[model samples]
Structure formats: structure tokens, C-alpha cells
Target: TLRPGHAQLAQTARLADLEQRLARVEQAVGATPAKLSRLGVGDHSLLATAQHLASRAALLDSAQLDAAESRLTTLLTKLDQVAEKTAAITGSSDPDRDKKINELYELAKKTEYLSQVLPQTLERMLALQELHQQGGEFAKALSEIESVQVQLMAKMRSNGETLASVEEGLKTSFATIKSNMEALDGRVKALSTKK
Candidate 1:
């Protein structure tokens, strides 16, 4: 039931959220390129990927489908590396680390799924272009494509919300685990001192 205007608003909001998250990620990843390098993740490439995604989002907003499609294709090629990085990070043997890594993996998979949806959206746009060139009735086609775009935007918003929830949950779990570890360490130290 999303209108085009509503869809645009939703897309814009999600893009803004994505940009903020990307910034946070860049800050984290940039702070420790050596750690990522040790894990075989090219830090430069990750930053580049984020920039490319931001540019593609801008292009999509401007209706530059061809350019956006090219960018998207390039982005898709980088997904594997990102996923591998996530897997490597998750492989560390830490209690809360596993949960956080799993969240990251889930987010990466969702990103891949979203990328796959882009090609289909681009295809529809291309089809609409062809219809327009034929000098025939393209109104219905446009409407249908717009509807598809709305649905895609809705799906993206839902995924974004899910990612946010996972991140929040991870933060809470980490706090709890850290508190318990601190208490246990204190108890052990006290007992050792008494002995």
C-alpha cells in the first residue's frame, strides 16, 4: 500500500541510516586496519565499497539507472570478501564475540540479498525504457514498476530495522557479559588474596 512519494521518503530515511552506520563502521574499521589486514580483509576496499554504495544510492535517487546498475554490479563482486571477513572475525573463540559475529554475518547476507534485488529492479526499469521507446502505452508499466519499487523499499526498511535490533541486542549482551566477567574476576582475586 505504499505510494511512490511514501516509498521515496522511506528510501531516503533508510539511506540516511545506512550512511550513518557506514560512517560508524568506517570509524571502527579504520581505527584498526592492521587487525583487518591480519584477518585478510582489505581495509581500503571496505571503505571504497561504502563510498561506492553511497554514490550508487545517490545515482538511484537521480534516476541514473545505468550508472547505478554498473556500480551495483561492482558492489556485488565485493560481497564475498566482506562475507569472508565476517566469517574470519566470527571464528574467534569468545562468548559475546560469536553472537556479535553472527549478527554481522546476518547483516552481510541481508546486504547480498538486497544487492540481488537491485538487478531485478534495474531490469524492470530497462523494460520500462524499452516500452517508452516503442511509443506505446507505458503508463501501466510505469505504475507496475513503481509498485515494485515501493515493495523493494519496504523490504529494505524491514531489513534495516532487523539489523538495528541485532546491533542493540549485541550491545546489551556484551554489557551483561562484561559485567559478569568483572564480578567473577573480582571474586577470584579476593579468594586468591585470602589464600
Candidate 2:
């Protein structure tokens, strides 16, 4: 009893709903911290390492999801076209009318299954993409932090070298002053002995 147009409309609505859900997931992922602090990841280095691992994993998952989505899309399009053609021929006295109806039924079932399952897969793909984005951002931030730390260490080393130089200069000046003082004391003692 279902019309072709009605089935298409229902599928379209389902797709729209799936899209909205994906958008929400994307927004949530963006809003959360990249460090995954909620998951008890507290250490900076650990978070950086975890993000690196996650980036690779997400990349692989996204690629797989892309392939699956593409295949599902192709299958869905073919099914839709076949369903339309089958529905068009239903009114004709074709010898394979019953067979065509059965085929149409089978297509509808497959289409419904794909409609139900594809959204979940797409949702996962979107979430993985968001995770990949976050990992990249975290890696960039860690890199910046490391650069700053290196600059700070270099500055500290320069300051230490300058302090050592100053200390050596002070030691030299003190030694010269002490030598001069001893020589003057020896001269005064010789003069006092003559007196």
C-alpha cells in the first residue's frame, strides 16, 4: 500500500534527522577539551601521546567509514532507481508482475535497512573526524609548548654562563687587591724595624 513518493519522503526525513544528530555530535566534540580530561587523562605528556595515537586511529577509521559510506550511497541510489521503475511498471500487465512486486518489496526492505544503518555509520564517521581534528589541535599546542620550553632553557643557560663570567672577574679583582695589600704591609714592617 505504500506509495513510492511516500517512501522517498520518509527516507528523506530520516536522513535529515540523521544530519541534525551528526551536527550535534560535531558541536559537542568541538566544545569539549581535546585533552580528554573527563576520561581521567591528567598528565600533559600522556595526553600528548594519547592524542598522537588517537590521530592515527581516527585517520584509519575515517578512511574506512568513507569507503563504507560511498558504497552505501551507491547502493541506496541504485535501489531507489529500481524501486521507482518497478513501481511504474506495476500497473502494466507484465508477465513478471508478481516477480517485480517481490523484487520491489525486497528493495524496500533493503532500503529501510540501509536507511536505519547508514545514519549510525555516518554519525560515527563524523565523530571520528571531530576526534581527529581535536588530536591535531592538541598536537599543535604541545609543539608550541615544547618550542617555548626550549627557548626558556636556552635563555637559562645563557644567564648561567653570564653569571659564571662575572664570578670569575670578581675573583681576579679580589686576588689583585689582596696581593697589593700584602706588598704594602711588608714595606711598612721594614720601615718600622728601622725606626
Candidate 3:
């Protein structure tokens, strides 16, 4: 329903708006290269850092990995040598080892039993000494004897306790040593079999 003059005016306004939009798009496009250059600078630094890290990783793989492998090989060799030396010293087979341990254990038990029984024996001896000392003339000598006997019993008890403790310690130590040796022997056998 518009007249010819109005239609021409509307078309001119639309064309002007389109031209303004085109100019703005051209301005953004013109600025794009500068923005990309700034981004490229950041990317270059990041790429350099990544390359440095990669080189370090490669160095670690070549140097540290080889060193670790060599150390492990050396340790294994030493273990093998120790195994061989142990076998030589202990002999290829020890049938008496367990028997000896059992005998030592039995001896320790007997020693412990004797230690316990010794105090009772000393007490009985003291009782007998007291019965014999009822006469006045022998009283002083009996007193002296009793004192000496008491001191002797005390010393014996202390020595017995110490001996028992020492024996127990030796027993525990020997057992631990035996266990460790057995474990080592098993490992050596396993390693030898593997080879």
C-alpha cells in the first residue's frame, strides 16, 4: 500500500543499515591477525616447555633406567654369591642341623629344671645345718656357716637366673638365625632353579 516515494526511502534505509553491519565485520576481521599473533606467542612458550620436559623424560629413561637396572643386576649377583658361599660353608646338605637344634633345646630345658631344683636343695641343706647347731659350743660356727650358706645360695640363685636368661636368649637367637637361614636357602634354591 506504500506510495513509490515511501518505498524508495525504506529501501535506502535498509541498504544503509546493511552497509554499517558489513563495516563492523570488516573491522573485526582486520583485527584478527593481531589477536592470533598474541596467542601464537603464548603457544610458542608452551611448546618450548613441553619439549624441555620431553627431553628430560628421555634422559631419565636412558640414564636413570639403565642405572637402576645395573644396580638390580649387581644386587642379584651379590645374592647369588652369598648363596653359594653359604652353601659351601654349611655343606650342600645338613641332616644334623635339626637334630642339633633339638638337642640344644633339651639341654636348655634341663638347665632350667636344675636351676629351679637347686634352691630347694639349698633350703633342705640349711634345715639340716640348723638341726645340727642346737649345741651352744657349735652355735657360733653354725651361725657363720649359715651366713655363708645364705650368701652362697643367693649367689647361686642369681647366677642360675642369669644363666637361664642367657640360655633363653641364645635359644631365641639361634631359632631366628635358623629361620632366616632356611628362608635364604629356599630363595637360593628357587633362584638356582630359575637359572
Number of the predicted model whose lDDT against the real structure is largest? 1
RMSD list, candidates in order: 55.1, 37.8, 45.4
TM-score of 2: 0.38
Clash pairs detected, candidate 1: none
**What is the model-wide C-alpha lDDT for candidate 1?**
0.82
lDDT of 1 at 139: 71
Off by over 4 Å in 1: 1-133, 137-141
Query: Which residue pairs clash in candidate 2?
Result: none
Order of models, best TM-score first: 2, 3, 1
Q: Candidate 2's residue-wise lDDT over 131-177, tens digit each? A: 99999999999999999999999999999999999999989988988
**Candidate 2 C-alpha error for residue 20, in Å:** 82
What ranges in model 3 sit over 4 Å off? 1-137
Ranking by lDDT: 1, 2, 3
* TM-score winner: 2
